[model samples]
Target chain A: MLDSKQMITIKGTKDGLTLFIDDHSSFEAILDELSDKLSEYKPKKDEPVVPVTVKLGDRYLNDRQKKQLNELISAKNCFTIHAFDSNVVHRDEALTWKEESEIRVVNRIVRSGQVLEYVGDLLLVGDVNPGGKVITTGNIFIMGNLLGIAHAGVNGDRDAVIAASYMKPNQLRIADYISRAPDYDSEGVYMECGLIDKEQDKIVIDRLQVLSRKRKDISGFERRMLNG
Target chain B: MGEAIVITSGKGGVGKTTTTANIGTALALMEKKVCLIDTDIGLRNLDVIMGLENRIIYDIVDVIEQRCKLKQALIKDKRFDYLSLLPAAQTSDKAAVTKDGMETIVSELKQEYDYIIIDCPAGIEQGFQNAVTGADKAIVITTPEKSSVRDADRIVGLLENESIDPPKLVINRIRNHMMKNGDMLDIDDIIQILSIDLIGIVVDDDEVIKASNNGEPIALQGNSKASIAYRNIARRMLGETVPLQSLEDEKGMFYKVKKFFGMRT
Candidate 1:
């Protein structure tokens, strides 16, 4: 009989307790060991409920397995699940992430009553006239003037941003929040960027330089330039 | 075959009928056979503008419904021997003329006329669609106002989806002093938004209204600034390179004295 303690290990950290499961064991064996070990363990008297993080190293767990593991952890009265950490992700999830990070380049004017929509980030090379709209699930970057409507982070990604050379849009939306241009004429001579201010829960326009600090992972070339 | 051009402005009261009348008359003055088709059906105005409302024995609907021959529906202009007007029906609605009916009528007119100018009604509904269906080319007219320019942009966008040639722009009703004082939108600004080839610019003149009221197109007068502008537009349509007419007012002797004294007028 192999030692059961080698399949699962627990360590105390500043935040809470971390449970590491061995990838070499079969999923059924891991489940059996987890249930046996958690049930046999006794909590110290008056010891408050400790948050636990389960780290699955190189292990893939589908929804059903994850649910079973979560149920087993919850049955233990002394511990609460803080998070689930995994080294591997499903192909579909990785594909969605890759798509969200990609930038699509388009070169055409978006005229009035026209709509240009994209799944990922959009990089438009021409102007967006009044009554025109550009919608995207990710960020939007316009090389020409933006005198129309722009909706970024359309899929509820609050971190998405909108940047334009001449940002005089009629209306701007980031995630679920909507904002309109001020009544006074604000003809921006320089490029500008718009993002959601989480503190105020409002869409705020800022200088283009703010994008560099906010979106550090936007482009590898920019990062290389900064590092050099 | 004649080139069919639809003169359209998405908004109402921006001088669409007047433009159609003047362009048709100007082409006639150039000695070219021109036919003007009014597509505003229930709200017909092109005939009134051309001063031919009394001679309407048959209308476009009658010709389309085969109630009369095409020649019988054409009302000859009193001033121009080569110009004719096909009035819209005041009794029927815009839906009375289908797209196929319009195409047939315009194609028949094209075989005889040198230029067929269609005066499209306002808005992007059936009337606008019926007007543009038979045309080979489009001309979008707009004033310097924000609303007019925005609507013109929408019309230009819609026209792009059609098989016709790229639509040209005409900025109508430009006031010189207001433009100079930065009160109205500049010509450059309107062009920037619409982003289409500009065919011509028409200066706002009271003479246009007066000529329309008298049932005579301003282009036939050959004296007013509006008349000259319309003539230039017509010449441009005939493939002539006509320079844009200056919008500056004629300087008087008092204005010249002010310039000599280095004083603002």
Candidate 2:
């Protein structure tokens, strides 16, 4: 029978702990093993920091998927993850976490003088009137007209986009960049979206089909610093 | 117990007082005992609109302060046998009206009347709060303007938080031609914004102005199309399903000519 340590190894280093998760097993199974092993494996009694180095041994994960694994490690509240390493090549298809995100739906016209705020992707079935505002940390999906102010990537995520059926918006903001409606596109051509472009310099408004590709590239995983 | 229905339009001058007088008189005409309370306090208007201003001897302040009995404070409207008016104090401010006092008065009135229609004051301050204190339901009035719709939306949020049921919307002063021309907000636009059950839709008519100036509610007159609309609203409030009259009746010059020629539309 294989030993538990061989399946998922944990070693002590001068600075922190080094965790090696076996690649043969599924990520879920690996996570279960890691969680179980980490919870049971306590460090030296007086250790101040719980710095950890995770080696996936040739597995591919985008920033978001890596962030998920990092979150699981942080949930233990015993370690500070320094690095997430895998030898496998990062593929566009390997991006995960979009499936895990919450998509909030509201079926009401966001009227003037009203403010609608959400953390997840907001799907509104109504129009945003001229003095109304919609804000979200994730993407904004409006089934009705976007005639008001909409701010996406409120958490400084350049990837977040605002998509609407009628995109004749008064103002739009993506991450830190802000732009007003141009006179020519006073009435937007078709179903459109506003997103931060490749240069990360400004927000670009385009047909939704062309814009959604940028969304699929990043998915919905957010990466943040892990606290011990 | 009688239900307290507050007629409120968050912004000023959208016809909350006028609607109250009409609905109260209409309800009374239907043989239902109804009382109209001018909870506007210092800024009283219900008494004037109901033409019961001269009959107000003991006002709401006097009843609250024990200077007069609740019965004495109520002015019986001679126009309708079952209709009465609780006039607001011409002198005292909204601070004189307490939630507990209003609640007591409403509970007492509930014993004798079928409906208590409160004419809420403009703005969401003490006057508005005092009017809404004992309301069982709400009727939010709004003009088809951006500001009116905005204020109505805020009031709807407040009512959903405080009132028993989601407040019913009454879109007043809608201009059909402007709506068709895409110049003004329509009933659907206002409803879409407020997202509340629409109780009534009142079109802009000269009759409403004449009715108010004459101290008569259009509903009680039973003459003009506006009066019929108001009566239908009252009937609907009594739990009767009245189909809304569509605005497509007069489309353009061609339709008007046909109607003028007495041809079937």
Top candidate by lDDT: 1
**Compared with the true structure, what per-residue lDDT tens digits does model 2 show for residues A1-228?**
245546577888997888887877777777777677667767676656588898889777668868878888887566779887667654433332342255778998776667999875789998887768999877898998888899987878777888898887889988888989877734464588888777857888888788545665444444311110
Residue runs of model 2 more than 4 Å from their true location after superposition: A1-114, A123-132, A143-148, A165-170, A181-190, A198-200, A222-228, B246-265
Q: What docking class should model 1 receive? A: medium
Supply the global lDDT for candidate 2.
0.81
TM-score of 2: 0.72
Model 1 spans with C-alpha error above 4 angstroms: A1-38, A42-65, A75-91, A198-201, A220-228, B252-265
TM-score of chain B of each: 0.95, 0.93
- Cα lDDT of model 1 by residue, B1-265, tens digit: 9999999999999989999999899999999999999999999999999999999999999998999999999999998689999999999867789999999999999999999999999999999999999899999999999999989988988998899998998889999999999999999999888888888999999999999999999998967889999999999999999999899888889999999999987
| Every model: iRMSD | 0.8, 2.7
| Per-chain TM-score (chain B), model 2 | 0.93
Tell me the interface RMSD of model 1, in angstroms. Answer: 0.8
Q: Number of backbone collisions per candidate, in order?
A: 0, 1
lDDT of 2 by residue, B1-265 (tens): 7898999989999989888888888888899999989998888888887777787799999999999999999999968679999999989867999888998999899999999999999998878888888889999999989888878877876675685677898888877889999788878877766778998888888988888877877887755667777777899999999999676554679988999999998
